[model samples]
Target chain A: MNLWLLAAAVLLVAAFGPALCVAAVAAPERRLIAQNLATVVGALAFLLMAQGYGRSPYRDAALVLAVLGPAGTLVYARFLGVLPSSRTVLYGAAIGVPAVVGPVCAAVGPGREMVKVLVIGALLVAGGTVTSVKGDRHG
Target chain B: MVSTVIVIALVLVGGAATAAVFNRDPTRQALVLSFLGLSLALLFMAVQAPDVALSQLAVGSAVTPLMILLAVRKVKRESTDQDGDESESP
Candidate 1:
């Protein structure tokens, strides 16, 4: 198996699975936090999947997810009034994003595609920051 | 290798979908529904359909959950309003 696919599989099992389990059974606050974590993890997985398959177009889904994940959390906060701050997700993005995006960006090299990957990485970090900050204010 | 990723996605999607259905509260269920949306998008990507995955991420991850939450809130408000009216009338 390719390293990218192996990483994607590991991410799905290590991060996304636990996030899903937390979202399934935890209280509303915890569940929302888990949901937020899922988005970041899922986005990273998509990035890895795109690289694994050698398909540039597949990265768009990760881009869309980076933008949507925070917005979705805000929606839940508005309706449920339970926007607990998730430091784990914030820290995860801050560190995990570059860890994943850097390798992918290096693989793609200097180009418009590289720029796109950088932008998506920035978006993921920004989204994680916004959600965590907003949750602090609301919670 | 590809099949391994696909199988993982499939299992996650199934678990999320089942969780969404089993959760009795609309609000919590909405959360599971969004999770389900995300996993399904992953499944689509694993199967080599990025376009479908993109749309699914847009619609499933956010929009559907937002709609369900709004509907639940509206129904809850109306029920409370009716209860208030009955209490005042009696």
Candidate 2:
């Protein structure tokens, strides 16, 4: 793939994914689904770039986003008291595992293929957000 | 030419779907908007952006519906008025 195209994809995913997710949650109706989907895709694109064509700087950037994105969302939701405190703790535990594992895998795995895993893992985290948020609101 | 036409058609369809959201009730609006996301992902794939397509699928298909359901639940809980009958005309 062309380097610039890869870069553009990464930028779009990173900038728009979380923003849309946050907006969807805040907005009424089914917008949350759109935002969540955008977030997952965006995170996945960044992950691909980080592994396939990105430099160390790109990898590092993805790492920061991976850690902070859900954390920030959880925090915002918590402050809003949308979910219970116990749920936040659970989210923390869920997020913490990959936060440690991704860097470790990147350090030791072949060709630092951790990026691909991390991207998918980030999608999983996004999934958790969906589940937890949905559970709290519904059940 | 065909590709250009397709792209234009996709954009138009996506735009119309989004605009339709405002006219519908919240639940319908949300569902339609999610379809918009699907359409957008397809468009990305059509343009040879598989990575983006995958991401869109992951988030759009999986995460978005749950979130919308949650929001809808919250609204329902807060409203405490189930009947679609309110009598204030302005």
Candidate 3:
């Protein structure tokens, strides 16, 4: 087993299973938060797997995830009519993505691949902020 | 080695699907379904198919849940409208 990829896979399963369980049972507003958290965790895991396997192409999936995760949350927030109302979770994710992605980019060194990693990190932070912000309508 | 990761993905997918099935409310089910889609993309990526994973992430996570929520809202609105009309008729 490739240890790093294995680690990523394990993290994914560990976090994802519980998050899904929580989303299934939690209240409406809380379920949305769990879903958003799962998206962030899943995106990070994808990036780790991409780095572990030395496959730049795999980052595309992560990139898609970083962009889409918040958009998905906002869609739910819109229809469900509830935003997170605080920035703690969002800020944590925004910080966490850069802390993880920066090291991976540095280890990979400067190149198109490093740039891609940075872009994904930036997108992840931006998306987290967008979704976590309190909206005009509070549900 | 590869199969181990694949097995993990399979387990996660199975668990998410089971949760989705048992949750039994369309709005909340939509959240579980979106998580299912995200993890499904992760599974595809783990099995060494980035192309498929990208497409799956693009459509499955965001679009599918939005569609489900919209459907739920429409059904809810229609039911409320029916309730409103019933009150008016008396």
Q: All predictions: root-mean-square deviation over Cα?
A: 1.2, 11.2, 2.2
Write the residue-wise lDDT of candidate 3 on B1-90 in tens digits: 567777888888888888889988898888888878887898898889999888888878988888888888899999999999999999
DockQ ranking, high to low? 1, 3, 2
For residues B1-90, write the lDDT of model 1, one tens digit per residue: 999999999999999999998999999999999999999999999999998998999999999999898899899999999999999997
**Which parts of model 3 are misplaced by more than 4 Å?**
A1-3, A86-88, A133-139
Considering TM-score, which of the candidate structures 1 and 3 is the better prediction for this target? 1
The global C-alpha lDDT for each of the candidates, from Candidate 1 onward, is 0.92, 0.46, 0.81
Worst 10 residues of 3 chain B by lDDT: B1-10
**Reference interface contacts recovered per candidate:** 0.89, 0.00, 0.82
TM-score-sorted candidate list, best first: 1, 3, 2
* lDDT (10s digit) by residue, model 2, range B1-90: 325423542753455364545535554444445545544654554355656755665565445644765787688876755433343332
Please identify which of the two predictions, 1 or 2, would achieve the higher lDDT against the true structure: 1
**Cα distance off (Å), candidate 2, residue B32:** 20
TM-score of each: 0.97, 0.35, 0.90
Could you give candidate 3's per-residue lDDT for residues A6-71 as a string of tens digits?
767666766666777778788988888888878887888888888878887878888888878888
Clashing pairs in 1: none
Cα deviation of A123, candidate 3, in Å? 1.3
Off by over 4 Å in 1: A134-136
